[model samples]
Target: MPVSGTTKNTAYTIVASSLLAVCLAYIGWTWLMSSGNPVLTDVVLKLPLGENGFIYGVKDDRGGATVPFSYRYYVYRELTSNEQIASELKTAGPFLVTRDPAIKVDIQGSTINVSTNQEVYEYHSSTLFRHTNSNHYTPVTINLCKHSSDQPTK
Candidate 1:
């Protein structure tokens, strides 16, 4: 015997409703799990340089000794302006100055990696302007700190 049109429609509706309910439950579970977890913010620095370029005096939040607050730092190469470079350099302070023999930077491809005595930081290159025809080098420094409210010392 063949199934009736009404019966087929009812079966289809049941399947669709069950799928929708499952999707809603999954979404709710994901939200609940994420809400309880801590969220971390990242700070990035971009430095533009040609092959064999060098950067010095790179430090981590822990006075260049250890990584702090689980923050991941990066330094890469990208297009930048003179004013912006100057501002970042000033903000980064004399540590970024190459005068320190302890601090040394080596450019590998379009990225430069900065490392402390204990940890090494990986740098990322800009996908949008990685291959630009400019020969200028710009150092971008990013600092990641815990929110004042979240910090226990504060």
Candidate 2:
């Protein structure tokens, strides 16, 4: 039994439409789940950690004229197995946010020290855990506007 040309065309159209709908739904879901809109700023710092990896900082432009800007930090490294380095690399973070415009990062052994205007935050390389089979790490967010004086009123 041979199928008609019109019938085959209909089937193809149905499959294509279903796939398009699924893709659109997934995109919408991803957009909805993300936090507030943040644009990557021009500020970036890099600290080399041997040949295997390095630590970096990227600031996000989240605040307007009334609110202070926020900065985020990250660490990146090449995956290794059996003492062999893999082409693929992994990243973890935006670990925390700071309001300082000029932040400094330094690496001492496996520990990364971040210096801000008010304080210094330290993160150990061993404690950073990227999701299995995924390059995303569990992010930590700290509140910088705890004091009423820092908050911007509407």
Candidate 3:
């Protein structure tokens, strides 16, 4: 027996439809995974060592405002030898209390920049004034939080 033209056409249609459906599903899954996390692609942190200490803030590349996320300050002493150097320090709070609520800071490269709109706020850590050594430094990490009202001004 020979197959009819109608049957052949129906088989081709079914294969084509199945392939199209699979492609659409794959595209949808990719979109879902990417849209789950809002990431800050470009961030700049400016930390100018002022009379008080270091001023911290972040420039929002997305053209919104940056708010203080979280920070940890520590005090360390230098332990160095002819070949190797280490530090013995006291670790302080990854403090939840906002040091300056009105001020925001972001990490850009190696420096943390403060917002210019407000007066330069001081980062108060007891060890901040203790030493000016390379081994004695502060490490701060920040995350850019998007607000509901943060829409592009333009």
Q: Which digits, one per residue and each the tens of the lDDT, describe model 3 over residues 33-121?
A: 65322222221222444322333222212223564332222222222331111112112222122323344555364344333232222
lDDT score at residue 125, model 3, on the 0-100 scale: 23
Give Cα distance to truth, residue 139, candidate 3, Å: 35
Instruction: Please give the range of 10 consecutive residues that has the lowest summed lDDT in model 1.
Output: 92-101
What's the lDDT for residue 99 in model 2? 60
- Per model, state how many residue pairs clash: 1, 0, 13
CA lDDT of each candidate?
0.39, 0.52, 0.37
What clash pairs does model 1 have? 47-76
Top of the candidates by lDDT? 2
Q: What are the models' TM-scores?
A: 0.29, 0.43, 0.29
Error of 1 at 89 (Å): 20
Which pairs clash in the backbone of model 2?
none
Say which prediction, candidate 1 or candidate 2, comes out ahead on lDDT.
2
lDDT of 1 by residue, 122-149 (tens): 3333311223356654543422211222
lDDT of 3 at 34: 56
